[model samples]
Target: MRRSTRLSLALVLTAAAALAFGCGQQGRLTSPNDHASALSARPAFDPSSVRVVAAMASQDRATPALLALSGVVGTGTSIDAAGDPVIVVYTERARVANLPEAIDGVPTTVVVSGTVVPYARPGGGPLQMGTSTGNDLECAAGTLGCVVVKGGVDYFLSNNHVFARENAASLGERIDAPGRYDAHPICNQTPQCANLSQFQAVSFSSNNTVDCAIARPISGLNYSAAEAGGYTPASTTVAAAVGLAVKKTGRTSGLTHGTIEAINVTIRVQYTDGIATFVNQIQTPGNFIRSGDSGSLMVTETGNNPVGLCFAGGSGASFANPIGPVLQALGVAIK
Candidate 1:
């Protein structure tokens, strides 16, 4: 699906911090342990923060400081005594330069670690999180990626746009691994490709915020929770947060890592036929993600912790639906 222009509003707040991990008066949440507590506190930022961030990105302005920060992936509410949204900057360097106290009304928060590079998976060698995946037909390939459990079965996790044609696909459709695009290159000679049938469609839902679908796997095909490039699955899910380090393996982008740019973002996406508006979505920088990267499972780069389901991206930005809603809608769990 082609992405439409993102719609968002700017929201400014106060407070700031920069470091590997620590705490301060301005508000600093550097540990996963603090997520639950911070969430409970409800970071204080206007809902329009998404728009604010988008506008800043387009105008090349740095009012929130996040825009000016090169390594900063995005901004989100921070855990201050009073929960308020802080501009979060993500970087791979140990030491950052020219740290600011605050931008506009929002403060700055910095996270150090992880290079963001996007690549594609085009050939067939092994079945891993970065392997190609797609319909049995001519649709573009994506990542077959991720392992989830539903009804005691090992179902492959991916985006509905990938497996279900974005709500247009039917249940029980044939699913291919190494996707049709990769499985067969002589597509022009014939309408079909050498698709390796690996899984059968189970269910999909675009009803909620997620664009996810699952399929029951068949025997004889190799599969694993491990992602490409040696990142093993943590077999758990993590909440999306600013400054959180995350990774994903996709048909186009093998194993790439980046940080959460924005959460609870509402945006519009263009499918082949029409448009769909997604709300409460997770947005990230356009680092390694690209076409054929959709349906890749977004996970923590360090522990392989599941975070979100990547679906749409364009214009230096990518978006994913929260994993919680995707699992809830499908009644599944990370395997």
Candidate 2:
């Protein structure tokens, strides 16, 4: 069924501490095991004190802080918690109805776009854009080369189609983000041992009903990319409109833009496998996204709040699943 109908919608930390115990217990003066308890009681920062990096975007609206690197940053909220990295739209921007508020008092500046991998499987693998088998796939076609999200457990969010041609259930292997400018590949080839350095999905799902997937990374592994001078997901509701200009960050296109032509247009997309498809969508008449641009974040001009996830676009049209529904499905808040 080829139709042009429309409607629209749509971690962790680990540290190693060296403990020094005096060789002679009688000679050493030490407190009891209460040290662990005290550490828990006295965290370095209050719940709200976790510092977040806020960057300024140029009139072009692209924030230097986020755009400095080739990655994703859509208008998102940190609804999960201030302490855990930031939370963003499941497939939408800054704010969704009833989602939590922005991290209390963080300063925000104008952003042309925020990079994102906006869609994920129900389990949490990212909806990425890449060939099932082909090129090195180093540079992406959009503003955001990649993105990070949280599912509260070992799972991280992503799109399953990134691994097309290969059987999803069969290709149970997970992918680690290829490091910048060549440090080392996250996952080694079949022969080598598992590298503890990068992210990986335990499994994936892209059946006829859903287009997303979840990959469980090492426990206590944070998908948050802010530490690398990039932006992560956060929730903040922003108003959207038809004809309102917007921008996006994705894996393929670093930073691009267009206007909202329509909203609430229902449509269908055949997942790469061709056996499964997704129905019901929010459509945009912009070419901000393309094939390799699968999991991009679509955002408003000023506040950088993401309005939708960039799926497929052609004929001067784009499609997205409202962030609101995505979160509800995931049962987590973005703000």
Candidate 3:
């Protein structure tokens, strides 16, 4: 007989954490026969150009001072309407007085984004990507970004907070599909839920570039790379560039589209355990993600090539780790 356990409301309430923060079945993974391929053309803006690199350097140098300013939250590189590289400063309020118009000869702009927080509001099949998932020990939930292959083994991809409990989970910990919050009373006790085991997760105790983790599937259960809404991400990864159109499918926000607002970003994100700083990240404006949407993969809208791994967000902005760094950090390739 299957054991059933009812979760208490307090456990659910305690699960609230930053968005930057998921399991299934003995079923073979299935994907569409025709998966999306990378776009044949390159973006107009060359992020590797000298001008863009100089602007990125300027942003990096000024980040310390800018983050110290009142209302300032983060800083990054962006492209202005004139198609020139510029420095972007993010603030909690509408404006921060006395911010410079330019940094090291590069132009500057300000964006009113509230305090950035991890989106961990915290999902089935051979469980699909971009669905609800979470640690079985807690009531919180978050999105399972996608699948990656390492050493010929398949693993589920998502933020550390979602699978590792912000570095609190041990290796081989159980992860539940639909997360505890989404599962509610039944939680991880249902046959429909797929259970996964923790594999690799970056520790939050040190400075990290990506808030990412990978979980191995229990025997018999499998996962598919196909995201919700039928979007298929390419196996290759691309660097983020300002003005690049992108889209993501997540647990909270389904499939939402937005343009790359900034890149080479340096920002501090509030997690359940503490504040952590991430450098060289990707930023998007408006409602790209909401609570429980962290871990959604940000891919190029045109060809669905992977670009960034969604993690944190603030009032007018959402943030992600560049896919290259995320993959390198976890030593995995997109499946």
lDDT values, one for every candidate: 0.61, 0.35, 0.70
* Full ranking by lDDT: 3, 1, 2
TM values, all candidates: 0.57, 0.42, 0.61
lDDT of 1 by residue, 69-122 (tens): 655543333444465545445554545677666656566555552442212222
Better of 2 and 3 by lDDT: 3
lDDT of 3 by residue, 1-335 (tens): 01124444444321111100100011111122111121112234456788977877787678778777888766656455455776766666775887999999998766554554222221013567888887776666788888888999888888877887777777777877777676423342222233444433444456668888888877787557899757888998879999999999999888999999998888888876678888898999858988888888999998999999898999898999898988887889999
Residue 154 miss distance in model 1 (angstroms): 0.3
lDDT of 2 by residue, 234-310 (tens): 45634456787766655444456678777656454543334333444556665666655554556666666656655
What lDDT does candidate 1 reach at residue 185?
A: 22
Q: Against the true structure, whose TM-score is highest?
A: 3
Clashes of each: 19, 74, 21
Instruction: Return whichever of 2 and 3 wins on TM-score.
Output: 3
Model 3: what TM-score? 0.61
